[model samples]
Target: MHSEEDAASACAHATALIAAGRLAEAREVAETALETDGPEPTLLLVVARAHMAEDEDDHDDDAERVFRRALDLFPDHVDLLAGYAELCLRSDALDRPGRHARGPVLLERLRELAPDSPQLLRATASTSVLATAVAKGPSAALVQSLDLLQALTTAASPEAAEKDARRRAALAPYDRRLAVLDATLTALARPGRAPLRLLVRRRPEYLFLAQLTVAVLLLARHVLGPFPLWVTCAVVVLLQLPLLALRLLLRGARARGGARASGASAAGPAPAEPPLPAVRPYTRRQLVLIGAGAALAFSAFVTTTVLTHLEDIAYPRYEAAAPYTFRGMTRTDTGDELDTTAASDPSGRVAAAFTYFYTGGSGDGSELAVTASTGDFHDATAAMVYESDTLLSSTPGVGSLDDSWRADAGAYGGWMQCSRYVEYITGEHKAICFWADKGSMGSVSFKASDMSHADVEGLARTTRQTVLLPASSDS
Candidate 1:
């Protein structure tokens, strides 16, 4: 004989207990409410939440069972669907192949119940972004997420929008997801007349367009020999400037027309004037169509490029020459020949060598190897060389000719010199030099029983100037 107020009070008490971290107490209260007043949606939610609050391995399983039973009783409840969807999203069930995750299903149901609701739209959009990420990739998910956020911000109440902005701002510094969201929001909120405002607002479309343009530029470069990346980028920006200006002009015209219409309506209409000739200017739909066409063209160009240059792109050509002389040692054709390997992909090229050797005056053998790669490898090579040098310096009984002797290979070069003379570990004395220019790197190891530290240094310099320079220049 419990009243409705008693049921409400019991549900509230259970919610408070769960929030206070008293899962057992919350479960007890919810169970008591269910027994007293039958299975109500609120009581069921409380019971489900209480089970979820437990930190056991099987807590999610128990929570799912409870939620399923509650949903059976109250199928279309927003609170129940939101809770279930949230649970599914947080669980690994979504990652299972060939299985439909409950999160999307529940979110879709919630969307049906409240299509225009800000909270429902946000949840649905977020879930869609996650689902898209799993199925497609981050880029596709990013585009969808940006569109959803733009719509959500435009439709939400001021308070809700402010809260969204605050949440994004707080997470932007630490989380990439929120950082992207913050950037999109910032672009959307830009002043109407600001430079690139129109382009930024339609970022996803423009980004796609930019991608297509870059792909075409890459294809053109491949066919026309070579072009600088900065030059290509500049051309793309210049091409888009006219379109941006047109959009700005259209926006201004629309604003002015609206103002004139307001003034005319306020003053009352006099006589109808003859209509001007119909002029169909470029619309947003038209612009989108143009972008789609460009994307399709880019796809064809990329496919052609891949098919035509498959061998050259997949397996780049690598060339290296053995040093003629090193530290008064003449060329020995009997020694190790240059063993070269080259690899390439859409990113860039990498060339490696292993068996390039030299013989000193005393018949002592030495080896020189080089690895050259395209793109930014400066910092990585520097850090790796520094670490190796530190370890070599710390090794006992290892001495160097001049600790201050640094190789100058130009602006984009990193060099390290170490001695191979070990008093305690094998009496074999040698000199090791590692140098990098831009993305190209080389290592020279000199082993000669009578070779002085100065002689090794001279050999290292000669190796850099002759053997490694050619490979680095091509990089």
Candidate 2:
């Protein structure tokens, strides 16, 4: 049986062997120690490392299991926790969706044990950056990443710090994380960078403040008249100054608390004293509520603005001076005009009234109908066509003689038909065409009993070109 000293030495030797890339020898030494001592922490760590070194698919799982067993024996052992946390980091175990997984639990415990430990800081920072990128956005992730890198550099030894710098520089061109790190380092190297770095590191909540400020500014712009660039810049500065002062006050309080704790610890425990009242600057729940409220308000304001703009586009006022004439229809008729602007409709529907009509000598006619308010004629024309289809479906005497087809009409396009019959008005079958151009909706219905489908389509196309195209060109 091996002595305690022999087992300790064996564990050290096995660790050295594993570090030297001697996996087989490390495994043998670790297995022999485990058989003799029945699973000490150091021996288990060595065995876990040996398992991790093996070139196999399940090596990570095997090493994690071994580390877990060691952790059960020595829960507070920093080295075992560190090793397990590192394994978790490599495996992305914290990113998995679940409640308090082994990886996150161990990392939190390690943070409590050694808050200023560089390795732990680095792991937490990396994981936080990744998590923030997924949850928030790229800008937030970049800010958090820079903060962590700063913390890492402050906590790490000179050699390790230099190594990290070099590694980041090497990876900057290929990886976005390293690129952000490099940019932040460059910014820090310049004059007057300390204050900026301090703000980023201590006041990450400023990112949310900035977003809210922008949202408010957009809401203002929509409500009031447009402001100049310099005015907007001044507004942002004015808004942020108060928040900056508050952050500074919180930071000062934290510093003073740390100093008091250090002094109390140095003087040893005092006699039983009264507990101090809790003073929290901000809680996680409060921040979440604030963010959610701000986001919802911003979304509502933006959506309302967009819908208002679309409504204005969909129901624009009709312009009377605009030309609404077409070929094979020359005689202007004004008797059938219907104006309903004076009458109130309870349904609140905007009334469409026939504005003008042109009749041909051969009993062919085209009519121009327009709503009282001007709107996007594209949508107005589409709505009118849809209404016509509904009428055809619901009206007993109205029926289509052939399938409708699309035809290009000047700068825009519309639908045309060879034959559409109204049995109640039965004298001659007619072709029906509807088109939108130059911000106006119009329709042409002509005797089509002797007209071919191609002839109907051609007539509709030519009418749109002659009437609407010339109006748009003149405008």
Candidate 3:
């Protein structure tokens, strides 16, 4: 039988790897211990950890199974239970859209078992708030959760009461963690206090370089003002790669410097190692170029951002389409009228007309549109196609719509006009007149007090009939 020291050392090594975020290495270390020593409760725990590291999809039913096996060996294991519950929460098999879900039930069980446990309480409360938020968007759920958290934070527990005594007696080290968390929360809650500013201050070089690259993209956007912000962001990301490399190089240099310092301190005045190689300094010309590039990048970023904001503020775009006559052109270049008088109403109505479109006549008909809609222009169209087809296809790729979908969804403008465009395209050709009301949808004649999911669905159905697929086209 192995000595206690050997087992403890193995455990320590595995734990160190885990703390260093070398999870794969930790798993290997753990597995080695288990394989060499034999089956044990701690070995099972380590094996479960290895499974967790391997499971990228977060579908760690295997890990859960291992944890359960560990629990069987050593019952009432809090860590194992916690891990299992977390797994359940991540997988949609447990916590779902419905009111009664496995996640909620599991959480309730956890609460019963560890009511006063601060960690358990925090996790339960946070998850509860998250679920509520998912069901009802952020504004409503965030406020409720914040209130609950604040109230709970104020209460003194048995642990808190004996903090000083516990600290002196060395009975509790983890209690101090609560104080740190509390302070962090307090700082986070402070008004007009931007944490991002603090982040920039701490890592000014990284932020500066990143933002400078972003600015260069914005300058490009300013030069070619029609490009979408998302596209600009993509460009910025691509441009920033070189800077990211530079940052990594600099970080490596710092790490080497730190290592050198640590070695010097540890050795305690080692015979001066043959005078260290002289470090190269930046040339004046190189420094000037770097400074100029930085200045230009920053200037571009500031100018582009300011201009974009200014443009948005000054010449505010409207959602609803302006009243215009739509005539099929008889002549290509001129406004000569043809047979079709396809005029769009001020509402800009459309309908969901399911049809298929050929991609290319020359190519092998591999990519043919199965489900296409006229009015269903937004993300819903693609979502519908994917949802309908996922069951049939083994390997799903290239979602419902093309790149044009985003542009069609009004990528160029703000939400206001986009909202109207949606109404026009989606709303059943039912006359939807826009007004200056803070909250309302559709007809001015019928005043809308509030909107429900059913109301939206009803509107969708109506839009399908009236605008999207007019009876004439269907018949």
Candidate 4:
């Protein structure tokens, strides 16, 4: 071994010797070749593995020393770095947390050098703790991590979680719960899954997400407008679509982001890469209980939402008192003279006008006007009359459409929006607000010289509460 090529040739021979089970001879040949030739990472790799392969009680210590020495001389060598990292992780001998600590530091270095390297997967796969691998981001690509985890879970018993985790007395980053969440649970759950459970539990992620979805759906049932049974049921199932789609999009983005973290492709013909690493997951029975509990919880949640919102399946137009007082104002009928404007709505739902003026709200001569123009609003009333905000704002009776903003009608199920602007030539400063809940929808207008937005919204809430009562007692 007189030249670099000779050293390379020698590294190959030593590797063959180690593979042939001649550990002592492999060490000797590699060390001798290093003296004859120059320093070589591959040769040192051979020597280190020979020590690692030896049937001694402390083979790790010897192999680790060789790797450390090689890395010191050739700190940037890919194979040396990968080999050393694997050794440290293998013995659970991570670097102490420090400025240049080895545990996380070694892992970071490998990530920088070959982020997408198959060798990284191989080196880190043997690590007993899945938590360490999964912290922030998995050490390998998501696809590789999934593959490694699958391998681990395959070996794990469907019932023995503690058996595989092999918990230690001291707290470490790598712990049992990480893989046990699904590994063993997947096994136990797989055998008994009916079609629905199969669909629900096919991906552990789906099972968890379904629970999350149920929670959100329950919240929506009360807040959304009345729907017939069909619409309500459709809403219950369709709600999961957006949540699942969001998660899947996020997962794919994470995979793409990690895969592109580094751009250090090799310049020449790429060297032979390591094969994908095998994984061994620990399985436990706790997840089975968790899944069962989750399934039950989800079912109960869905049933509860549908039943509680049974009131939501129908929206009978609310009955209104003929006369009422709000704040400092009192309501008076505007008489039998037809409100031609209300009758002009395209859908005819806004044809029956419940128009009134609540006067005496102020000594400054300000009055609050409310109009419940009713019609076929529950179905499709053109955006112009009962169903439209923009169209309503543009209507002749809604003051001038100068400036407008949306306001909430609180408990009356606010589709109530506020508009603070009015006509081209009128000196009157009016703020108008409107609300919609199925067939029950109306507007309130404030005709005060200096009425603030809050005043308008406040009066609108009072008006909606007074007029939008549930169906009259008799019917």
Whole-model lDDT per candidate: 0.55, 0.53, 0.39, 0.57
For model 3 the local lDDT of residue 66 reads: 76
Per-residue error for 362 in candidate 3, Å, reads: 55
Order of quality (lDDT): 4, 1, 2, 3
On residues 1-475, what C-alpha lDDT tens digit does candidate 2 reach at each position?
A: 6788988888777765554344666778788878987867888888876876663438767888888789889988877887777566545445433312556887889989987887576556535646534422334243434434454447454345435654643532222233334334443445654555555444535556665666666566556755654665687687677566544543443344323332221121121221211112334764675676578557856864785576445532343342444554453656545435323444433333344445544643343222222224434444555445753465444454455665455445433332356445665566666655325455555566666667776766655444333224333
- The prediction achieving the highest TM-score against the true structure is 2
Judge candidate 3 against the unseen true structure and give its global Cα lDDT, from 0 to 1: 0.39
TM-score ranking of the models:
2, 4, 1, 3
Off by over 4 Å in 2: 2-29, 48-355, 363-374, 377-391, 394-404, 414-424, 436-442, 465-475
- Model 3, 7-58: lDDT tens digits are 6667666664443234555567777777777656665676576566544444
TM-score of each: 0.33, 0.40, 0.31, 0.34
> Which residue runs does candidate 4 get wrong by more than 4 Å?
1-313, 322-353, 358-365, 373-389, 392-394, 397-402, 422-426, 472-474
Candidate 3 Cα errors over 4 Å, as ranges: 1-9, 36-39, 50-55, 58-62, 72-75, 90-102, 111-241, 247-475
For model 4, residues 1-475, the per-residue Cα lDDT tens digits are 3877778777876775554345676788899998888677889899998886653537767887888889889998877877777666655433322212454567778889989887677666645457334522332233433442453345444344323322210121111222222232333244442332233224455555556555555545556743454554575567566546434443443344323221222222212321233343323453564576487657767776676756445445566554567666776655662345565666555535576777877632247767775444554222433345665645565555665666665775637667665544565667777676655666777764566667777767877777656666686
User: What TM-score does candidate 2 get on C-alpha atoms?
Assistant: 0.40
